[model samples]
Target: MTRRVLRTLLPAAALVWTAAVGPAAAAVPLPIDAPLCGPAELERLDGLQADLDAKAAAGEAGRAQYWYVDPRACRLSVAVLRGAEDAHTEGFVGAALAASALPAPTSLTEVDEPVDRRIARVPAPAQRGARAAGTLHGGSAIYSGTSGLVYECTSGLNNYRPGTTTTAGHCADAATTWYDARGNRIGAVTDWRYPGTDWAVITPVAGWSLPNDVLGSTVPVARFGKASLGEAVCGRGATSGTRCGSVTAVNVTVNYPDGLVKGLVRSSQSGGEGDSGGPVYDGGTGLGLISGGASSGSPTFFQPLTF
Candidate 1:
């Protein structure tokens, strides 16, 4: 019965929070041509981000995908879904900054695409062992219960910490059990941090061996590293397959309908649903986990491994 229900509905685990409020101050939109932010600016931006989130909850302005401090432009950068921006947006941004006693945002970029958790629910295929990287590659399916409900997410790196692997926190919440492509009970989510961060560690069930290699790659993950601006990168997700792009920004704060996630790695790579928790790497070096992105062909964000 559970399988039947899961097979029919697309279940995505996300939380939503909303509030009501008033008008904001007036401001103008700035162009996006600045450099990425450094440490000091990132600190200031973090506090300001909290203020903006409060305004969003109070309905002072529409919700945003995320916001960050662009060091090059030396101003705040706010990202919203394409066509959602309007006159009131600028005002709201100005007001939010004033309330926080922070500098005004320099620009508001409309994300031509939408950002979302990469998970899908479809009919179950034949179950198999988790060792087959090709069949159960990075952008493969993750099953949660005996029911047909399954989350299509990209596979992350092997932690080598005995019976553990990594994925996006939103993919499997704490205490939630997961299964591999073959319907084998993988393990329960042991630890997870969301809203602030977006990564989770899963412990495999007894008798299951966790592989060191990513789903689609031939090289075994050696270690994790930090992402730099203009650094070449690539990501593998179940929905969009594998796509590569460059790191555009770091230390970003994304405001999902459910809540806010900070310290994200922004990139030019595009990803879609079912890509969450996939590995973001540069060759053999693991960098981060796919958090969300603009549709399937626009800039996406990831939860950095170092964070």
Candidate 2:
């Protein structure tokens, strides 16, 4: 009986669930008539999707759930299947263009498109890491979203429990590791908020300590004020470091590979991977958290810091 119980439990424990949030909005299907290449490009797009479906089904990739075709920008974004390895799907992007009259895509950008529905399943006390511009606060690389790098600040509660705890929405791409200044893994991400709002509260699991200081760190926080269109803002992230720009637009629909993000503020500040969940601030006031940027470098979108 003991051997049988062990055998059953081992297989059940071995299962790996590639978790993700659902689409922020309903699935907006890609129309066949969306217009890519003239008549010659259909096969290429179809073949690419076919290959993607195959790969996704086999767990080699996640579904390319969202895509956008903007003739004005001449840009096409396709969401890849799950797992970071699915990034390889972009490598085949050339094939998609082969069937199109459009010129071969000069570049392919990958962004997370987390949906609102999946937020509840996210772990708590999700772990993450950051590399500061330099040493500060008696040392660089503070753990929370508020040290090292300078960023826009906002005001809000951590998990929206009335007046429980106010927290920042910085630190995107929630991980499961307690990382050090030099990028060493110390813990794992226990919980995280992906799609709903950028705000997520992280608890210390596996014996990690939350930084006690708030000065001169990259940990994001809320300041004050409601941002408007064309408002100038500053942002700091683990990637692209610190940069200042203006809010280009608001209530924009951004399609991330993870899912759709609606009612987002679009900004001109440039951000890249590891920059997700960075603070979007109106001067010293916090505006939102970096969700994703436009496929082109035209603008960035962030989840407004609303508690």
Candidate 3:
């Protein structure tokens, strides 16, 4: 698994451009005429994904490492690991595409390499000496287990049930207890979904209260909702801090070396290690949890909260 830190730092060049072009045009660019998928299409896509998974598990076809609906192209796309595609895979893709009654994939890019999850080894620089910034707030530092085998992550949201909260499932094991950055015992994993949907719920120990707002910001989160294309979104993580970006696509499935995850929200925002399980929100509404992202200047994917 990988962790990311969600901080937004503006470059000097960007500041200069913003001043020269005026704030109006400096806004994040929206996608042009991007097709939006309705709830029904999303359901159908899920059904088709199940069939593909079954076929792969049965050894009847090559494994489709990842599959997702690209609303911008109004089609579904699947990614196969390089050197894994064969006649069986092609046939499986054909049948799945035909069964969905949707447009074919716009492209069939082969994944040349495995998706690396080594970000867990990279420590967050902000984790040290800034005890004041390490309070238990949304986007604050979180971890499961004690030292040595600990898995670090970011707090996502505060559930309505007082001490209950959520984060990326990959960050917490059901058998392990969780703690805050200050070494205070916080909670334990109550439930989790991974290798499919990446989400987990943590129930805090006695006397701990969940906050309604993310740390270091006034953005309030009351409810969860689906992200629309072109929507402006922001995320907060312990490693990256907080960064704002635009929604590029939704209902995306990514193929990671560990396994596959579906129904993700893709954004132009960048994230680094320790940002996983952080909150992805727009204004006051919660949208999703940061799953993973590339090194830099690349899109990051989030597990949608509505799922």
lDDT of 1 by residue, 1-307 (tens): 0100001111321221111122332332235554445677667766666667666656555645677666664556676655565655656655644433233333455554556655565555466553423223444556655445455555576673445777888877522776666666666778788766888877766665556667667877777789987799988876777889999788887777565677898998987777788888888888888988766556788998763
Give the distance in Å from residue 83's predicted Cα in candidate 3 to where it truly belongs. Answer: 7.3
Candidate with top TM-score is 1
| Candidates' C-alpha lDDT | 0.65, 0.40, 0.65
Instruction: Please write out the lDDT profile of model 2 over residues 75-190, one tens digit for every residue.
Output: 34343323445444544443343423333221133344332211111112233453332222111122322233322222222222322222223342433333344433333333
Candidate 3 lDDT score relative to the true structure? 0.65
Candidate 3 Cα deviation (angstroms), residue 260: 2.7
**lDDT score for candidate 2 against the true structure:** 0.40
TM-score of candidate 3 on Cα atoms, chains taken together:
0.70
lDDT of 3 by residue, 133-240 (tens): 223678877766445556678888787335678788777642347677656677778888886778888887777767788876786788778898789999987788
- Candidate with better TM-score, 1 vs 2: 1
Using all chains and alpha carbons, the TM-scores for the candidates as numbered come to 0.74, 0.41, 0.70
Q: Which ten residues in a row have the lowest lDDT in candidate 2?
A: 1-10
Better of 1 and 3 by TM-score: 1
